[model samples]
Target: MTPVDTVDLWVIPLDRPGDETRTAPHLDCRESARADGLAPPRRGRFVVARGATREILSGYTGVEPKGLVWRVGQWGKPYVELRQDTAPVPAFNLSHCGAVAVLAVLRNGRREVGADIERVVGGRAERLVERFFHPDEARYVRGFAPAGREAEATRLWTRKEAYAKASGHRLLDVLHMPVLAPRPGRRPGRGDGTDTGAVRRLRDVPFDDGWAVSVAVMGSADFDVAPRLWPEGP
Candidate 1:
């Protein structure tokens, strides 16, 4: 068995006042706010997520958050820019919904990561699974008892989205990719048995308060996912 590289994840709550201040100095919150054009509530969440991303990455890179450079891929994935003289660039992804944000970072030599989080909402999980999930995934979700369908659907959605992000492929392009079914008494495997060297592992992040997070990494089967709650700053 190969040694699994560990992935570091940070779950930050955006509802607190000081959340913005903690990472505000490291990101252009005002510009992001303007570009968002969303109503106040949504805009506020965006600011917190963006700010927290910078702060978290800064801690890992030892660079001022505001000094970090980023570029967006053709598929709209954001990545840190690396200078020729800088150390190896880390792989990271961020997702936010409702009042929480999730950030996943992988610094191993095979750095590639994607993560997503979604708040559980009633009455939409089945519909979403029907419309967006692969045929097998949809069937698997439907196979769950009616009372358990929503949570299972949410898990599948997050897993699929995370894999898509990690692969840098459009969500539609990867919908057909199969996902491993959750074992009766065990955790789901990282890969959904479709490992072609791009996405070889998956880890479901554990959180409280009805939110689900999933992370996908591009590497060998020996990789571990570690989740941490970001502390509230003064």
Candidate 2:
């Protein structure tokens, strides 16, 4: 887990995030928990995510995981208070959906990065498309179905979530914004540097059979995604 990796990411199961690797520190859960009185699912997942994140960060920072730390977001996004003599300038975002949580870290002068992954549950894809996807995107999604449609749906959902996550907001009130679309040969993830196509054929991101993973980058000349995974059951 050296720092030379290309915008590395770690997707850990909220249910069972094993020993913390210290790539990051789980510094947000306690405050969020007390403020919101988390639901069972959120509590469990958040705890595991925190433990692992802390462990990960510890490995990198040599900082142990036994303290109260605050990861306050300016306007609800990650922000760090600059300490004298410390050059704190890197970009990252955290997102969790269903039972999994992801930590995306970007370095080497990457300004901003966002990532999202969603399971293509039964009708959730179509329903979300109708409810939020841009109109033309809806039609484009219609061109595919239970067969080749997964990819499209995954792309839409991931793009949507990536933006929301990037903006430090959830999707509850984001439907009014413009929808995202596919540009062939675009970077593998949702964001990167792909331009939205004409007619905006972005009715929900295409979904793969197992999961839909999308990422986006804003205000950057070059952006990309590097993926990491941690399974729940050993």
The candidate scoring highest on lDDT is 1
Q: Listing every candidate in turn, what is its Cα RMSD in Å to the true structure after a full C-alpha superposition? A: 2.7, 6.3
Q: Write the per-residue lDDT of candidate 2 for residues 1-234, one digit (tens) a residue.
A: 333324557777766434323322454555445524767666566666766655444443344544424365644766333232344334566777777777766653345556677776667687778767778767767888666565666667777677665555557654545544345334332232223431111112233356777655554333435566653244
| TM-scores, one per candidate | 0.87, 0.68
lDDT of 2 at 107: 54
Candidate 1 at 19: error in angstroms? 2.4
For model 2, what is the C-alpha lDDT against the true structure? 0.55
Top candidate (TM-score): 1
Tens-digit lDDT track for model 1 on 1-234? 666677888888888876665655556655465636878676667767887788778777777777678898889998887563566678899988888888898875366788989877775867888887677778877788887778878877787789888878888877777665556434556454244655457777777756678888865464677777786353
Model 2, residue 181: displacement in angstroms? 4.2
